[model samples]
Target: MSALLRKIMNFGPAFFAIGYTIGTGSVTSMIVAGSTYGMQLLWVLFLSCLFSGALIYAYGNFAIVTGQTALYSFKKHLRFGKPIALMIIVGVTFGQWNSLIGILGISSNIIFEMISLYVPSAAEHKYEIVLAIAVVIIGTMYSILLIGKYSLFEKILVMFVSCMGISFVLSLLVVHPMPAEVAAGFIPKIPEIAGGKMMVAAFVGTTMAAATFLSRPLFIQGKGWTMKNRAQQRKDAIVAAVLVFVISGSVMAVAHGALYHEGKRITHVLDMVNALEPIAGKAALTVFFFGTLAAGLSSVFPCMLIAPLLIEDYRSGQLDTNSKQFRIITGFAALLALAIPIFGFNPVKGQILTQVFNVFVLPLVIVGILFIINNRKLMKDYAAGKTLNIILGFALLFAIAISVNGVIALAGQF
Candidate 1:
């Protein structure tokens, strides 16, 4: 039992990567994509994960080689390094905090929905109920942040990711997509439908999240790994990317099977539950919300940390979670996230802005690591080889193409 437990725990950093990437943003985007286009965008999801694996390995290897975090390495090594690193720090931090607002709002709404399932009249007190629930949830996550230990973070994320992945996989089983349609999704063709372009960009934007790659080094450092653990790090990246594909695909599959076939559309995240109850029974509702909660909390924990993590990474190669900066930043993020639920603002709008902004930074992030990893001085003898370079070159082109079209699609909405 102990040996088996150790094996699960060994994928600690992978869980951190997976936990943060496969959150509310990914779930909402997948639901919309699945319901709207019925698995046509699986190609985008697949490519995102494929490149994400390459970027993860690149960023992580750079950190291991330099014995420094990502932003710091860029600051010290590249031309205009300081400004570039600072831009990433600002861009990624802003995007993550914005994501927190949406994550908290969705999580609390789901809780209220679950409560109302039993106490139907709970709908009458929706505002106060959601606010109170948000407080409790945010407070618990803040308390976890205050604990300030990487092991604690890793363990909690493991539980959340496991719960979320298992629950979603079970839900997919309850309402699986057609096997041929699932296979066809991988053949690379976008539907010529109205929202196809936007959903494609969103799938890429959310799954290939900037926070995921930017934050990888810190998580890797937290685990005390270095170049000697190269093999393990490679294994971990693969594990993380594969899990993102499986879990996110399961979500898309569920929406496709449960809602698409019935010609139902889910406009809001809560609509997922409303749409499910009639077809899949209350048991499925409980499981889906449970997974959503896990996804939300897992994401919220990382969003709260990203600000401090990036700032510390920029200031120095080392992380000081016990520092005053960590406390102040995380506290501010928690309170700001609660505001979305408290004021009843549209988190979807904020998330849309965040997603679009992320696409812009995606190319920059890929460019930075590409230059940094191939530098012999910084990497000494272990600069990246030709094969990895080819993969990143393609990833960069993909990011730029997505960025151009994503902005246009988003602009077209208004």
Candidate 2:
């Protein structure tokens, strides 16, 4: 392949990774971060991006060296045996289920709003049709992935991410957040917001997926990456990390400039769009809706694929990315995409719950990855360096702290 073509091909996995991160929780989390903290939490975004990028490089490199996914590596290196592996497997399954719920919830709201616009009179009875449309869209996504051609899906996602970028950029230009506030956000200070507790929880929760998704290990196994693939993997991680930071930052800027300044808080993705109409016009509302839909659907595609792959790897004792069983699992997960719309839960709430689960799952995986990556036997000459070890150690502590705080907050809500 030509040098230019290789660079383009390399973009595929990174795009897929970012698409996965920009899900329902991401939309709400970024908006909440902006509305509640304004630019104060901008530093969190930058740090999380760096943390996620480092993890991707570490985990992706591990997968290449050990010839296993993160999950498989955990089982092998930890020697927790079948019982422990089974428990982790169950946790992952539930995580995937929650992800499906969050995705469908966001997509359903967008469709609901779209319908209300065209047939305002029928708005009262649109839930049934909205459910149907959600099913059709999700089913089509499943069919495309079942064909096992990720290239097409990646292309579509890149286009969607591009559209989302454009929408946010346009909003940013209109809102024009003060340079001082923007700079403050990048400095990392907690603000005295109404939902300070929840905002903190949400910030950690939102970035939880960033670290965990990059740690999947499946990407490395599927791509047949090795130690020799380190440079490519690093490049891929950089692309994914940069895209995540820019897109997320843009969303924060839009929300801070447009909604926060008005003292109008938004709890839902639709609310964010609705808030934009007065400032940026109805067309801006449309653009916001499209961005939310694109982010939700694009993330759903990867979740569907990952769910089955995780299961198949456990049952076969190997990571076979192309197995028929894996494909079937992806199809089954697609069916779940329909159920969330049919149930019609609040996307904002669902996103919070999903993110909480993601944060809950992070500690175990981080511990496992840290142990495995540092194992001299497994990594040979590629073991974690001093700087990498220090970073991973801090991440582990941060994950635990966030998990504990998240559980307490969740329990208090109950």
Candidate 3:
């Protein structure tokens, strides 16, 4: 194989990170932010990606140096380790599974919208049709999990992620937003409008995702990285963080160009498609929805894998694809994910709300990693240096601050 191909293959962890991080939740939050607040929240996206990169480096480094999974290390090495690890598993699983509900729901709704566009009469029996579509999506995604190895399965998700990134990038090029306003968005002020604080929280929630970092060690382990591949892991983390910012930023830009300037907001999933139509032309619906669907599916698969993946991490560092615990837990997750689609509610609000809720659980994730990565015995020379320590400190503080805002925003909504 060529050197380029080899380099690409080595960035497996980063590819999975892009596929996980830029999924439906991030896409949805970006769309909402851009269409609703124009470019004002790019600061949140920028900071999240920066911190996410640092945390990914920290977690992947600890895993490679110590040769163990995160929860397993937590259980074995800390005071009250078992309970703490179990609580993380529970907290992360709850946030992730709740995300799946919105993910599957949004995916089903988008699919149904696409079908209705081409086959106008299909809207008559929306419930039955959407329910069937949701089941098929769940089944196909779950079956993909049984594909035997992490490497092979992640490759399939790479296709979905590719489609997602390309569509938005192309749209942004076609109907670009103003560079001045886009530049202004990075100045770091949250909008004072209703849900503005919550939108900031959701943006952080999706970009600096808890699952993305919490599961980083397992993903690194699955990719077979060890101490020898330290440089490769850092480069891969950078690759993942850059792709996340670029793709997600493209989505936000496309939405701002198409909708925000016109004072239209994305109240529905298809509103994005409709907004893009006038600016990017008739292909807008097909192109943007294709990207959105890919984004949604990208997140769905990861959500299915996380609970079981973390559970196994807590039990032992080893991940057996064939284990009964993996199968049973994932199957239950896929089944429960159907609730949103079956109930037939519009999921955009729920999706954003879930993303905001994810913010509250993030501080604990960083706290756990902080303890382990700083342990001199466990990390040795790989222990976080001053730079990484400072980044993680800000990351923890950022998580806590947004989480408080998320709670306030959530309370007002109620």
Sort all candidates by lDDT, best to worst. Answer: 1, 3, 2
- On TM-score, who's better, 1 or 3? 1
Instruction: Encode model 2's per-residue lDDT on 224-341: one tens digit a residue.
Output: 5667877888799888888888888888888888888788877765576567778887777677677777777777777776666666555553545466877777777777666667
Candidate 3: regions farther than 4 A off: 1-6
lDDT of 3: 0.85
Q: Residue 227 error for model 3, in Å? A: 1.7
List of clashing residue pairs for candidate 2:
39-185, 40-185
Poorest 10 consecutive residues by lDDT, candidate 1: 346-355
Query: Sort by TM-score, best first: what order?
Result: 1, 3, 2
What would the TM-scores of all predictions be?
Answer: 0.97, 0.90, 0.96
Model 1 residue 349 lDDT score: 49
lDDT of 1 at 5: 76
Candidate 2's C-alpha runs over 4 A off are: 1-6, 81-84, 118-122, 191-194, 210-216, 315-324
- Which residue pairs show collisions in model 1? none
Q: Per-residue lDDT tens digits of candidate 3, residues 21-109? A: 87777788888888889989988899999999998888899988988888898899888889888888887788888889988888898
